[model samples]
Target: MPKAYFEPEYLNALVEVFHEAKRILERRGITHPVAVDAVARRILSLAQEGVPPWQILGEVLPPMTPEAAGLPEVASTNDIVVSGPAPDTER
Candidate 1:
């Protein structure tokens, strides 16, 4: 899908809010890339609707968690299993 565009003034504020939200999520241990990207997209959407940066920074970001950020609990490498044909022991 095409990326959303923003006015220069809104773009600047969106960038600032995006970074601040990233920092907040990191501090809260929501460091998953999906969560961070979701927050950034949300910030831009809200800004496009004319929400101010201060409100986005102060109100919109504080309550976010991994679930709130819309990311499912990620499985660790050890939790993932690859299925394949069994080895040929008779060879």
Candidate 2:
């Protein structure tokens, strides 16, 4: 594969996208460092391919389920919490 070259503007845009994405994940209580890094890297790659920053971030993060973005879930009468869904529960 040939080496990919990113222009200065794209590089700057990528940096901004990475920082913003990381901040968004942090604000949403995504404390896993690896998860945040993975999303940031995905956003960077998407930005390099000419995808807008907002779209790139959206691809990795789940959309707000009409309740409001990043808001804590209000436990109602039927709230269920799962301990671990699979064998490899660590992320």
Candidate 3:
């Protein structure tokens, strides 16, 4: 079987999306892992569509919580490991 690969650009996009998702979750005061995971998945989908990392924050995420409005904004991208390419469904 041939080995699978995650394209560099795809990996980068996924990383950026994850970062943005984390920030949105933090700003919303969402500490639940499940909720954060759900947001991360959505961010990946949007990132796959070539949505800008910064733009994804405003377009796809839930509105900022009132309490979060007063919090200082922080942004950072972290490294992510993509185990491998998605399995082919055509088989």
Error of 1 at 41 (Å): 1.5
Q: Evaluate all candidate structures by whole-model CA lDDT and list the values in order.
A: 0.72, 0.67, 0.67
Candidate 1 lDDT by residue in tens digits, 30-51 = 8988888887777777666766
Model 2 C-alpha lDDT per residue in residues 1-91, reported as the tens digit of each score = 4223256645666677677777777777887978987786777676657676556657867665746774677767887777866578678
* Candidate 3 lDDT by residue in tens digits, 1-91: 3222235745765576678678767766887999988777766666666665656667767575645577665556676767989878996
lDDT of 1: 0.72
Per-prediction TM-score: 0.54, 0.54, 0.48
Candidate RMSDs in Å, in order, are 13.0, 15.9, 21.3
Rank candidates, TM-score, best first. Answer: 1, 2, 3
Instruction: Provide the lDDT at 48 for model 3.
Output: 60
Model 2 regions lying over 4 Å from their true place: 1-5, 48-54, 62-91
- List candidate 1 segments past 4 Å from native: 1-5, 63-91
Count the clashes in each prediction. 0, 0, 0
